[model samples]
Target: MILAAGQPDAPLLELFLAATAGNVLGAVVNFVLGRFLLRFEHNRWFPVSPANRQRAEALFNRYGRLVLLFSWLPVIGDPLTLAAGLLRTPLPVFLLYVTIGKAARYAVLLWAYTTLAG
Candidate 1:
């Protein structure tokens, strides 16, 4: 969408803000779902894999809440946020780190789009 907008005219700031806001909102929703699903952590049908869950937990334990900065990662990202909720990572900290990661990602994409389009 940002690239599409740039095909004609780029509102880079708007695109960045909108993308970052959406990413933050989506992660928060994931966090809420993770919090709500805490009861099912031990269930056999739990969506998250035991191995991956353990890995995310270990990373969180080692790095503390700041690990949320990597929540933009593809394979491990969602699990990281889920683990954050499961482990009771503070909302403010989660939002801060996640926003930074997501915004940085979008900023890079937007920059690349503009550079290529130009």
Candidate 2:
């Protein structure tokens, strides 16, 4: 999008490749960061307080497994994964949800790039 926006008739292949590469890497980083760096029980980064965790836990206990469909949303998505991990939301299910969410998010990003940037 940057190139296309800058210079008309920019190479589509290169832009697509670059966008895909970054999105894939970003998803990996999101998963890894959730698994390793962040803390759900005690969020050091933001306002994912224990009270909030409890509320999120209650939600997770109920509809969490499904929210994975929206796992790519800003703010809540990344921390949701971390909370899922800390709460021991079965690893298999968590991975499944996260992947689904990430895929959807990437799809939207790709479409946006193709439409506006391509």
Candidate 3:
């Protein structure tokens, strides 16, 4: 869609910028949905238990803010953010690290995509 919307031979830099923005917005949406899961009385998808959440919290506690840095890793990122919400990690702290981590991931992805295309 993006490519079709732009010039046929659009520059790589433009694509990188556009993709990075999209990725950041996607990360924000992911975080919002993760937080919303907690507000629900019953989440059918992966019923999160307090005990399991406690264990996750303990891991986060040991890791501290570093947990956010690793929050963009595959298989681990999603659960880590969900765990953050369940553990009531401070909103500001969560946002800061998550944004950084996700942005870094996006940057790496965009760079690789562009490099591989060349």
Residue-level lDDT of model 3, residues 1-118, one tens digit each, is: 3563235465656666566566556555666776777776356565777677667768779879668777768887776776676667777887788777876776786677657765
Error of 1 at 47 (Å): 6.8
Quote each prediction's TM-score.
0.78, 0.53, 0.64
Q: Each candidate's lDDT (Cα)?
A: 0.83, 0.62, 0.68
What candidate 1 gets wrong by more than 4 Å, as runs, is 1-3, 40-58
- The alpha-carbon root-mean-square deviation between model 3 and the true structure, to one decimal in Å, is 4.1
Candidate that would win on TM-score? 1
Question: Where does candidate 3 clash, by residue pair?
Answer: none
The TM-score between candidate 1 and the true structure equals 0.78
- The number of clashing residue pairs in each candidate reads 0, 0, 0
Judge candidate 1 against the unseen true structure and give its global Cα lDDT, from 0 to 1.
Answer: 0.83
Residue range 57-91, candidate 1, lDDT tens digits? 78778878877888888988887787788777888
Q: Which residue runs does candidate 3 get wrong by more than 4 Å?
A: 4-46
Kindly indicate the candidate among 1 and 2 with the higher TM-score.
Answer: 1
Expressed as tens digits, the lDDT of each residue in 1-118 for candidate 2 is: 3575247676655765565456445555555655563344355765457786678679888874787656567887666666665555666676666666666665676678668865
- At residue 79, give the lDDT of candidate 3: 69
Task: Give residue 12's error in model 3 in angstroms.
Answer: 4.8
Query: By lDDT, is 1 or 3 better?
Result: 1
